[model samples]
Target: MGLKPWQKALFPLRSVAAVVRLFEAELRQPEPDLVLLSLVLGFVEHFLAVNRVLPTNVPGLTFESRPGPDPQTRLYFPVAELSIVAALYARFTAQIRGAVDLSLYPRPDGCSSRELVRKVSDVIWNSLSRSYFKDRAHIQSLFSFITGEEGPPRVPPGTKLDSSGVAFAVVGACQVLGLPDVHLALSEDHAWVAFGAGGSQTAEVTWHGKGNEDRRGQPVQAGVAERSWLYLKGSYLRCTRHMEVAFMVCAINPSIDGHTDSLELLQLQQRLLWLLYDMGHLDRYPMALGNLADLEELEPTPGRPDPLTLYHQGIHSARTYYNNEHIYPYLYLAGFHCRNKNVKEALEAWADTATVIQE
Candidate 1:
């Protein structure tokens, strides 16, 4: 990759110029794999921060991971960084491929693709130090999977991947195995993989709640049939690559502490969410619409729809696509209405929410 002449460059960041030039062509492909680059970059940021390689106190002087559930742990995220991404991507890909050879798991099983997914899940699930803390926030990503540093070096061992991370790892591994059909399936609190024909096949690849071992090889429909609120009665996202990227966008944590947010990270998340929204990827993913609506409410984009419109679209998506089975979209809209002092409308929204609950 040739960098433009330095004299012609406003700021001579050769690496940035190289990646920008690379992306210009990559972005034009029928479908660009920006999500891979994004996740890898995110992992690099977290790896740098959590190893105590970067100081946390100063905003600009040093990078710091954002605070998650655990105040003691943080993960940094930088948008343009690419140097570490390539190496990490290769290592992580090889790590999973080495875990489960594709020849042993050629296609989806009758058991909802479990055989293949569990192999991927086990690699991540078993990688953590024995007795690591599972409640840390930022560890629910590939950063933890790749670096094995759930928190700062001083934070001590026992950093297990959160349940979602295992599922994400499985889906990502399948992608690495060249299985584009495999994708992440998400409900309110659980994550799994959807694969096979039309992404109709599904399997549990992560533990849902504590104490019980993971039901790693079971089909998802059991929960739906059992009427578990966790399944939302067939309401869940069988995500495409784009929607999965939106999921990562919604998962962005910008808190430097409980009180402050990284404006740069927040702005990046908002821009990415808006990009996905404009690309029509959020149509079936109501919670994404609600998440983007939350951002729009806080930062009101100049030319986009108002937060109320976004909220309503979320509700509409739930009703139309998920048969009104999803409750969050309604609750999100109701919360917005209540916060805005729309007393009568809020009550109506609440009533509608109750109707969904009754179903």
Candidate 2:
């Protein structure tokens, strides 16, 4: 039977309680510092992607992936965020050209590179997070000195260069900014953000290797294409696929037990499920929401007065997916989820609906 009005009202409240308890349980988990760091980095990466500090074509750099409860595991983001961040960074690096010495820190350790890259990314992210970058001139100044004269002709495909496609995207970004291209090498196995092109002081990205450049066989103007893709395709490839993997891994992996409570993960899943529902994805099958609730049931309940209230809270507290507006996936999932129910039969009767959407 459908829930009475009173029961429905209680539902959202119960969800909220579940969320709070889950959050508290998560807080109580060991090594809270690591979890906080992951959240910070995740937020930083999300901001960078949202603001275009990185490139979109590079593999293993997307913000779509959620950090797992396991602190030891690192998640990779996709190219869309990377492309945007790289473009913004390229612009900033262009401005800081002469002022900052790239040579002093050439080929630094992975941690150093991550630190340096994170710093610049953070600057752009923080600026946007604070909503303070009021003018283009300030942005231009940030990138002016970093861009230099033209560098080596575009790196040939077959030949390995110390620069990744993301680096060149930055180079191409310099071109976009009218800054001369700069060339420099970063250590292999990693993408580098360094200074020195052909013109005056310039910065370059150099780190060529498998999974670093665009292996998808995108065109030479690929950098331009990548920028366009990031600007247009909010759920670029990595966010779509890689993110799923990260979540799936987090959900299924049982080996890394103590650091993150499984029940909290289930609670998180419930929250995600409701978010999907609120977005109209689960309108056809309320049971899918029930599926998530069942999962969250595995976790021990907190001191909250009602379990349902906690669940709704968790749903409200979960982060929104990268782009929640576009509805293709929602429609697809709705169709799939309702296949055996009344919704499915109705959809089948209105087969033309699917065709119309495709057209």
Q: Find the candidate with the highest lDDT and give its number.
A: 1
Residue-by-residue lDDT tens digits, candidate 2, 1-359 = 12224322321212223333333332333211111212222223222322334446645444444455588763433322324334544444343343334455444332223333333322322222121222211121222122222334872212111223234333323222222222212211222233322211212233224333322212223332453322222222111111221222122212123353333234444554444444444332222433444444444335422334433332232214323222233333344336536586446524533542343
lDDT of 1 by residue, 2-24 (tens): 12233123221123233334333
**Model 2, global lDDT:** 0.31
The true-structure Cα RMSD of candidate 2 reads: 20.1
Error of 1 at 241 (Å): 1.5
The true-versus-predicted C-alpha distance at residue 145 of model 2, in Å, is 36
lDDT per model vs. reference: 0.67, 0.31
Error of 2 at 101 (Å): 11
